[model samples]
Each structure stands twice: as structure tokens, then as C-alpha cells.
Target: ASRTETVKSVYDKMLNSIKEKKTAPPNAWLWDFIAKCSSKEDIELLFDMLQKLRIFRLSSLRIHENFNTALCREVTKACVRVGAIEYGKKAALWRHNAFGLTPDIGSTHHLLLYSKQLNDVNLLVEVMKLVKKNELTIQAGSADIVFSICSGADRWDLMTKYGKRFVLSGIKLRQSSFDMWMEFAAKKG
Candidate 1:
């Protein structure tokens, strides 16, 4: 079957399950498949389906913590792949609001990664603001991405700001993160 057909089939089945009040949630694999298949055109469809699942209180969805984070990360990746960075931001906020999902580090990392790839300091700042608003923990990997973003953009101020935050938050800096921070500080001095 074609990708569209498969997506449509799964979409229909999920919708029917919600309508019929199925006690069991769909398998994690199904959600993973949807996330992997998400694209610019069909991203709204994916978001709508997720909203519906939450609205109907489908099978204690929040219980699947691992799946939820993976889904968010994959969806963010799909959005980045298609250059739909705004949609990705909206999706992250939407998941936080609608499903009570915390923005995971992986999702934040992916957005930051793309911000670096695009060399857009404004986008990097926006993603960081979202992270701050959501109070998501800054992990070592994400710190590396932020440091890289600041380094690439020649934004020493941003590097200092977030570097201090990471230090105060007690997040362990990876060796690469340390290297970038020190290199930038030395250059600034």
C-alpha cells in the first residue's frame, strides 16, 4: 500500500476507536509510525488526531511517557525536515497545552539543531524562550546545541547568558560544550 493509503487507514482506525470509546490506547508503534510519516502537508492532520485523543481521554495516554517524548521528538524532526519551523514550534506548545506534555529535551535539541543549521539566532532565541516558559530541564546535549548556536552566530552575550543558567541549574556540561564556551570566552576577552 502507498504511504497515503497507509496513513489514511491508520487515521481512520484511530478515529473509529475514539468514537467507539475503545478502552485500550493504540499501540506505541502506531504513534511512532505516524510521527515518522508526518510531513508539512499532513502535520495538521497529525496534530488534530492527537488533540482528539486527548479530548476523549483515550486510555490514559500520559502513562506512556517514553512514547510521548519520542513522538514529540520525531514530530519536531519531521517539521524541521520540511522547513516548517513555525509549525514545529506550534506543535511543541500545543502538545504542552493540550496533552499536558512537558516539552522534552530531545525535541528542544532538534529545534536548536535546526536553528544552528539555518544560522538563525532569532529562531534559536525563540526556541530557548519556549524552553524557559515550559521550564524544561537543560540537558548536556541541549547545552552543546545552545553553545554551538551562540558560537555560530557570534552571539557571545547569549552564550554567556545561557552558560550561566546551565551552571546555576547544575547541568553537567559535556566536554564539547565546555570547549566551545571556553573558546568563545577567550576570543571575547
Candidate 2:
């Protein structure tokens, strides 16, 4: 079947199941298949399918079941690959808000990963705004991503600004990310 037809078929099935309130397992292998699509358009089409079918929730349920964190990461990566930054950001947020599992540290870092991969300063800055508003805690990989973002942009002003927030919260960077903090510190000095 053509890619378009396949996407439409999968989308229709998913919506039908939702309408029927069926408890059947997800296509069970759909994302794995979607991730393997070679063309960017094909990948974007799959992302569209995901959005249309509410597949992000299905994937989130799998993550909740401890199926695999890698699948969560792969979906985020695929969303990024297809330039679905906003959707990818929303997916990352859902994984945290819905499942309570920090698939890359509570979506903040996952969104940071997407921003870094996309080299989207605007998105990064938006995340910074969120950090400011919520006073969110940065942990593990999320901390690393935020630190890398700060250092990559040479935004010591922003780093020093947010660094105070990190220090004040008593959340230390991971050992692996010490270098990034050091870079930030060095630049600030």
C-alpha cells in the first residue's frame, strides 16, 4: 500500500477503536514501523497520523507500563526528525504530566533535547520562560540539556541568571554534566 493509504488506514482504525471504546492493544507495532520510514515526508505523515489518532496517549500508556523508555525517546526523536517541534514538545510534556515517568527527566529536558536538535533558540527561550514561571526542578538529563543549551549559546547572562535558581533550589547537576556547569561558570567569570 502507498504511504498515504497506510497512514489513512491506521488513522481510521485508531479512531474507530476510540469510538468503540475498545480495550484492544495498540496496533502494537505501529510506532516501530513509523520510525523506520525513510523519507521525511513519510515521517511527517506518520506524525500527523499519530496526532490524529491520539497515538501519543497510546505510547504514553506503554511508557507507563514500563514497556520501554527508549520507545518514548524514539517517538520524541521521530517527532524532531520530521520538524514537528511543537507536537514533539507536547508529547514530551504529556509523557511527564500523564505518566509521572521522567522519560528524559520530566519533559523539560526532553523538550530541551528537541530544541537543541532543532537549534531553535526561540523554543529554548520559551522553555526558559517556563522554567522561570514554574520554578521547575532540573534533574539528571534535563539539567544537562539546559546546561548545554546555556553553554552552547554562550548565554552566561542567562546561565548566571538561571544558575542562581538551580543553586537556590539545591538541585545539583549530575556528575556527567559537571563539565557543562563548569563551562558556564568559566564563561560567567
**Best candidate (score: TM-score):** 1
Which regions in candidate 1 have their CA more than 4 angstroms from the true location?
Answer: 1-5, 20-25, 32-38, 58-67, 90-95
Instruction: Give the per-residue lDDT of model 1 (tens digit) for 139-158.
Output: 88988989999998899999
Question: Each candidate: what lDDT?
Answer: 0.74, 0.59
Q: Per-residue alpha-carbon lDDT of model 2 for 88-154, expressed as tens digits?
A: 5544544333322224445456678777776666788787676555545566566667667777877
Residue range with the least summed lDDT across 10 consecutive positions in model 1: 58-67
Off by over 4 Å in 2: 1-4, 20-74, 94-106, 131-137
- TM-scores for every candidate against the unseen true structure: 0.80, 0.63
Clashes of each: 0, 0
